[model samples]
Target: MMKQISLMITSVALTFAMNICAQQSPWDKADAIVQSLDPVTFPDKTYVITDFGAVGDGKTLCKEAFEKAITICSDNGGGKITVPAGTYYMNGPLVFKSNVNVHLEKGAILDFSTNESDYLPAVITRWEGTELFNYSPLIYAYHVQNIALTGEGTVNGNGSKKFSPWNNIQTVEQEMLRKMGRTNVPVYRRIFGEGYKLRPGFIEPFGCANVRIEGVTIMDSPFWVIHPIFCNNVIVRNVTVDSHNYNNDGCDPESCRNVLIEGCTFSTGDDAIAIKSGRDNDAWRIGQPTENVVIRNCSFRSKINGVCIGSEIAGGVRNIFIENITIPKSSNAIYFKSNLDRGAYIQDVYVRNVQADTVRTALIRFEPNYKGERSAFHPTLFDSFLIENVTCKQSNECGIYMAGFAERPLQNIVLKNVTIGKVPTPYCFQNGENIRFQSVKVNGKKLDEKPTPKELVKLRVL
Candidate 1:
């Protein structure tokens, strides 16, 4: 009888262990997504741009030579187009094709012209969430698969000279574009390029798959640097961006999926990494969500947020994993902002192992009522955020600041193993539920409960 009892106990234990092994962690999907990504590769064949009448003297226009090399490379079953060490001037954009890799050698610089007319003959693109025919991005790929921009070199967008000044003059055109989007105008009719002051992105990949941008240094972008829209299986690794022009966001992945952004460094004028979907009606019509993104081992020093999720997230965002982030200085370490007009959901976000040296604003902030022109009455569902293993050395404002809508409060937020060293205000929770804190310390004091309204600090309207 004793032997039989021991056998039954062992069987039960084995079953329990199996069950535990079968249960998947929330992060298991991230691993699967990474594994499923197809690496962007090219054939061993090489097409040297210098062989195609390209001069690196920085005065001659190399557009024709580049076009010839890229065309020949793609026509002959695709290969690498090598740009040797020197400054090559491009008056127009370099549009990419499938299975082609543009590799720049060390000391090579592809200098883009600041002349607005060079980027005319508008391309189909989404600018700031609205679909329009706009100026071509400096480096653009559309509906291509298995394309790459690789090698140790620089792509300079001379925005400070001319393009940066357009920001102040673009307000009227920007408002008109938003109105067009709101009124459900046909995308074909929403064209604005020559007379409009809307700036173009530095590098944009639209509707692409298996895209890889690695080891390049980007600087002085007119608009967002490295904007990927409607892409899948994208990987941006080891790239350095140091552009401090107006609205020069380091990278904005919009309406993309299965993305991996790792080992990148950013010092930008705006958010270091801002994940977004489309704007409003345009996003709803497109019907694609930004999901399954993993951002790890990144360093940031930005004028705005370090890692952010939309003021333009109207489609939806989900299953984002951010870890091993180092922010030397930023307006906010982790920020989520969406106005009522956004009318979407952002859920299943996980962030861990973040270390911030200095933050001008809150360590983590959620502004459900982000400042924007609200045309509709649709509130976003912000839910299921798990932030842990965060350490902030100094924050000029609060440790945590959240202001959710009363109808749909921010739900299921868990902050664990977090410590903020020198925060003046601990927390400001306006409308939230199921917010649990474990092993969280603010200003050297363990937070046992939520602070009352009287203890809350007033925040300025950003």
Candidate 2:
């Protein structure tokens, strides 16, 4: 009887240990970490920003007040810097430091002045993947750690003003006239060359660690929104990112590591979530790939591709797992685009248990448009792509497409357990090696083909 009891206990212990060793997704850890931190103990409360002569400005540019507040918060062991209940306007970028919290009170608005001079040039930044010294982002953080932006308040870029004020036009086209250099603008534009050149955009946080942006609203970004470059251990949860204007993407996590983006809402004019490893020369300089990304329970609504990778995958991306996503509206539910300029391999990407409604194009696409997207700046490559257990309802077009360039094939991909509703056929595979499927069904029926890949490429592209 004693031996029997011991054996039972030993069996349970072994099972528990194995469960612990298994790879757990980011959502499992996100909620607990958020609850552990006490909001009252934020850095802004302890340091106090008044010493910097910063005041809550309603109309005028309160650059001094914000700088003082940020400086004080930085000096005093880093605390939450308060943007009091009012409109605080700034002409230039405000840099954030380590161990600090930038919390906006209810009804508070941090308005970034759109004057070109206000955003000083020569800031270390990346645009579309290329590295360059460009205009400052509304809220900038570089080389920081343990940072967070939490509140019910808003951060407005005032980008609309730039189009009307600088260029005297209505939208991105007029703003193009106001753009500093006509020649320079194309340097940052998408699908230009091998995707190596710098195209200026908004908000780049480089080499950061343990970052979080929660319960905040970011609107009217001047360019690609919320770009975290070469960061690690990042979390952006419970946030609302909305922009109806041009080129305002919700977030682009490029060359980052250990990232978790969950419980966030994204609605933008462009790709809601654009993943890239690096662009052009930076891809080679920063050879490290984006690793360990887990995006769960995040919903997106975008005019462009909902959740996309490449068009700027110069460095290579891997180990990306996007699950439990609900994209109600988009041109395409999930898109994987690559060309000759992007030489990096995209591998270990798992998109499962996702549902898309009212999709215009194929739900999941891997296309290397040979003559369509050739760039001199950013080099490109496509490899080891996978889509599984995805159900697209009321798709107006085809369901899945894996068509590649004649030179470089889209190889080692698998589509399993996919069900498409209200479509003729589920897939249209053009070129690739080791593409397989298992238990694949469309419109409640099994398919004639099987999807079997060579091996799972364990990599990271956040």
Candidate 3:
């Protein structure tokens, strides 16, 4: 009898251990993804821009010198193009070649010219999710592999003086572009440069692999600051962005896979980090989803969202993990927005360990009717979100807000250990199923039950 009891106890212990091992933390996959990434490294050869007849007087145009140096470095099989201290004026874009690392030493600045003519001779680029021939991005790369932009230096776009004013006039052209996208127009014919006012991104690497942008200070971006489109195995680390111009989102990773963004600081006019795929028919044609992204240890003080997932997510997005975020001030702490015209699935997102103060809107929000633009009948499926261990000091609006389409409601969302200190309203939810809250507190009151119909606020389109 004693032997049988001991055997039973051992069996129970073994079963418990097996169950624990089976229920691994979701971050284990994140760790494996990080381990799978390959760090970008260049050859030991260093080509100094000064030696190539580039003047750093902040007045002379060094476009030719840059072109010459980059070409030579690239021809020599791969190396570092080093820029020493001083301000270097660039009249044109810095078009990158494969296997080149642009390293800027401390106190160095690459000041881009504001003249639109400097960016003439349009390049094949994507503008706001639609493929077009447009002015080249300030730092542009296409189909390059193993590229990097690193150093403790500043890249000044000088955009507020020139491109910020164009935002007021871009509405008509913007609508035209969206219409073209909705109509499935061929990407080759969508040309808008020279006379068009659509602003270009600051740093864009399109269709590249194994890219890195680290330790750089970006400022005065006309549009999105650091945008990587259709890229794979990219890393953006230890970067600082302080651009407050219109549409100057700090970083946007669009249609990318296996991306890692960490140790970044942002003070932006828009979202600190916005993940996007493509838009409308253009997205459907491409059929690429943004997936396997990890963002952590970031600080934000934004005029808009702290971390956002699209108003341009027509292509699907999945398997995103975000943690250890601090938001001193923002319009919203966490936001997810999509519209009826965007037909895709955004699922399997995990967020934790976030702290925010002075949120102007809700701490967390899900809006399926974003912008109220219904050019098509396709509706996005918003599902499978797990948000936990989030705390907010105060919110000007409600604590949590959700609005989903009746046809395709938000599904399988779980919030655990979330607390909001002060808010006028606690929650506003509509058309969401399998939405659960555990240990959730708002306005110092525990939300133990589903909100009543009378408590649901009308949808206020942002």
Candidate 4:
């Protein structure tokens, strides 16, 4: 039995290696990044939607059909449940069991019907990592292993039909509700339980293992798209995620591990690529960090952040790498936000070979105000952040802003081979220590700290 188990493990490892390259060391740059993931077999099987009596009725709510199909697939050895080419108007969240793959074929759409009855509650899920007992997600994969949602189809979280897709409006509402001294959740009290209480984002795989989402379009989620919280060995590539409405973050890797997001296009309202752990007490409870994540070969447009971290990091995070990216036309290019209330430690993040154009807040932003969101009164630490080979043009404020509490400072944050539209002064560089600048430039004029003039000339020529 032991030998058989060893052989099975070896075979799976070999297959994974053959599909991509051998797994790179945590500190080493990958030799090559694969654009797609080859299917790996576990106990999960492939299930057809036609078997569950779905007739592709746009008006008809196919909740029962989808539930039946997922049930059937679960009863079997846990396989893939396919939605063929047509419109499947599913009403609430369709819960996926472990080892189930929800595939939507070409020209297929999993439309979310905007009805309260469709969203039954009392299950465990989150919005920005806050434990919630409200409406469920459009499609949820929780605590699963070796799972996926692939193929050329669309998962439409019909949020526009419900919530107000403007951040200013929602932010105002949240503040007004907070002033009113309401006891319920801020999202509920904000709208007085009337509006779509902020349509929760679609496509959340929570606490899953070995997940993949590729070759699909995730559009118009009321919230963040492709949120995988506390998952491991995940890959999201070759997907065009376009949610232009408010709070419509493209992809949020919150408290996940060993993730690779590459070859994707993101046009969103909020952060195009976000890293989170959890929010406040909920995050403190989970205490899981999103680590070993790589975001490469991607493009972004019309979002708040090209790449961002925090605003919810009750748990610590480390070992993040974002490389070979393009950010065109965004409010802010790269951002990092945190507060003392989070009680999380962040370290060892590297961003290299990034190119951005026509952006607002380019280069880097690490601020206590965090773009005027909330207060910065906690004790938080940020260290060992390296940004290199980055070129950004056009932004509003200072190129790089690192301001934090006096005690918990931002240290050892090296900016190497970087250039932005303009340069700005520091609020206080006392705590933001060990900030080395090598071969740096501002709007293409090379700065003085060029370690080697020959090497700097070569770099500038390129």
Candidate 5:
């Protein structure tokens, strides 16, 4: 009998070890998708802007020059349009074509004029999650593939004193747009420009594939610095952004798939990296989810969350992986937010190997009461979150704050090998289910509870 019992214990231990080995961290599983991304390529031909009558003296209106250059490049089956080192003042929008690369040399600056009228002939865009025809993004692309904006240069919006002030009177217009989204107005009919005060994103690539924006320094964005909507296979690498205007999220990827945001630095006014799908009814109508996104090797300094997942994610967001991040300061380190009005789901989110100096609010937050209406069209669900190997030096509020509705309790969460140096409250959970903490230390003490050994065996084996 003793021998039988010993054999049984040995078998169980071996099985447990094998199970641990077989279960891979979410980051590892994300590698297949990340590695599958292909770098954009361009033809050998070069179209120098100066060769097309573009002057570098900063006072020259280079709209026609840029238009002519891009057109010539596109007509010749696509190649690189080089902008040499000087201030190239752009009076209007620059639209890119497929297989084209706009390469700027080290001292090149593409300064956009702040005159609102220059952005006339509105284009289809989303403002605060609502789909409409708004003013054209400074650098806009639609339905193009293998397009790039590369080289070590700067794209300046020049929006500080002019564009940021539109928020003061945007209250009524904002409400009207939200109403339009809720009422399911035809997207083409929701036009706002000329007299409309809605701001446009600085660089928006809509419905594009194989897009790359690399080694560029962007500043003073009118709105979201880099907004990629309805795109696939996107890469924003080695980019530096410093935009502090209103609604100046560093990078906002909406309704995109197969995205990789790596080796970037951001100091912005809003969330450093906000992954969004769409808003409310419009999202439901569009019916496209945002998935297969990987954000890695980035440093963030922002007034809002370092990595945010919603408030506009009504079409659902899934299969997101964040790793090797450093956030010096922010309101929240990782925030997953949605309200009653935005009835989307957030799932399969993994955050790992992060370091933060100070988070003004919680290190991690999940709130179901974001700014929107409550509707039964979709039930808001937040689940399947894994956070490991994260360390934060300080937090003004609780270390972790998660609240779920009583009907749909947040479920299947695991936090392992985490540490927070200081926080007023280490943990705050309300209406959560199946939350597990293993080796999670807050304020120099391990969390006060853990699952029983029998229950531990049943937790998700991650």
Candidate 6:
């Protein structure tokens, strides 16, 4: 009888905690969205690439074999194209068809050539939110539904010498694209390829639906490692990404909906996962918000932010949930960044059950003043952000740092059940309203007016 009573008490406590979490936002709708997302399904057929005269010795270019396999599979009502073990050197991008799955067996490596000329005859894609005909991503799928890339094999970008060197020459191209983005230049006219210094992403699915990328080891990406733009019902599960180039973000879901990124490990030079919409005028024109995104059970070791909301959030971001995440070595665990040029609303974001170990800079950071070119659409709204049940082993800076514009201050930001071991600086807040902290601890004590870490260091020296 006592054991039954104890179980009942435990259930009641869990119910109470869930209810408290639900009270702050529309969790039921979010849960519904999550539950409805089904895994991508393929027809019952498989095409082996080696049968199509593909060699896997890592030197012979098998672009024709891959293309033929995809064609055969698509022609036969769409099925999986199997890539068996051994390194298959692809000289160009491989496009996916509807209801197709590219399955790689263990020990199979799909390595793309380093020559920029190989990825010519540019395909329609988005570069930093602007639609254009640019160099194709290493693996690209456009307007395809019910497609997946599933396997234990590696999709190697081979970007160390060839693509990584383009970063130095990208300044001119970057400024040109930004200018085109601001001026609402026609996307067709903004062609960049071949001679252009813009590097292509590793895996990107544009304007697609019902996509899944599972269990693939992505490494040495030229740009954003795995990017899905304007996609719906996307699932990226159990993928491993390790890239340390200029903009080697692990995964970026841009202008997408119903995205689930779970059980992924990331060690990258940029954000582990960045949610973006379009950029500036282009994003405003596309007008699609990146909503219904859930990032859970993930580990991140990044040089920059762990999970970022936006700096290219011109189409707004909403209804996001992040839970059960571990940031072992990142500058910030939860980072929301937007600037004056990004005229979008970032609201209804919740982060919970997060563990931060040696977060090099800050645990929770919100910078509404993320640097960008000024625009008339300035005052973006950031509201209803909640962080709960977070524990940090150490932080070099404050536990929480929020800065908002005076005209459009951040609203209803809540922090609950958070503990930080060594946040030597006070929680900083500016231009905010209704910011609440419940059971928040720093250095095993509740936060109060404390000397900065620098001040403490000076006193110790004295």
Q: List runs of model 4 lying over 4 Å from the truth.
A: 1-45, 165-198, 371-376, 421-430, 448-462
Query: Per-residue lDDT for 1-462 in model 3, tens only?
Result: 999999999999999999998898888878887888888899899999999988889998988888898889888898999999999999999988988999999999999999998998888877788888888899999998989999999999998999888889999999898888878888788888899999988999999999999999999998999999999999999999999999889988999999999999999998898999988888988989999999999998899899999878888999999999999999889999988888898899999999999898889988887878786678899999999999999998878998887789889998899999999988888888888888899988899755433245543444
Residue lDDT tens for model 4, 235-293 = 88899988877777888888887788889998887789888887655566557888777
Cα lDDT of model 5 by residue, 38-63, tens digit = 88888899989999889999999999
Error of 2 at 91 (Å): 2.2
Residue-level lDDT of model 1, residues 1-462, one tens digit each, is 999999999999999999987896777877888888888888899988899998999989988888888888888899999999999999999889888999999999999999989998999888899889999999999998888999999999998999989999999999899888878899999999999999999999999998999999999999999999999999999999999998888989999999999999999999999999989888988878899999999999999999999978999999999999999999899999898788899999999999999899899988888774556678899999999999999999889997877788888989999999998888888778888778889888898755333234665433
Off by over 4 Å in 6: 1-26, 375-377, 448-462
What's model 3's overall lDDT?
A: 0.90
Is 5 or 6 the stronger prediction by TM-score? 5
Each candidate's TM vs. the true structure?
A: 0.94, 0.79, 0.94, 0.81, 0.92, 0.91
Deviation in Å, model 1, residue 382 alpha carbon: 0.5
lDDT of model number 2 = 0.69
Candidate 5 local Cα displacement, residue 209, angstroms = 0.7
Clashes per candidate (backbone, < 3 Å): 0, 37, 0, 8, 1, 0
Better of 1 and 4 by lDDT: 1
Off by over 4 Å in 2: 1-57, 163-200, 374-381, 405-407, 443-445, 451-462
Q: Which stretches of candidate 1 lie over 4 Å from their true place?
A: 1-23, 372-374, 449-462
CA lDDT of every candidate: 0.90, 0.69, 0.90, 0.70, 0.88, 0.86
Lowest summed-lDDT stretch of 10 residues in model 1? Answer: 449-458
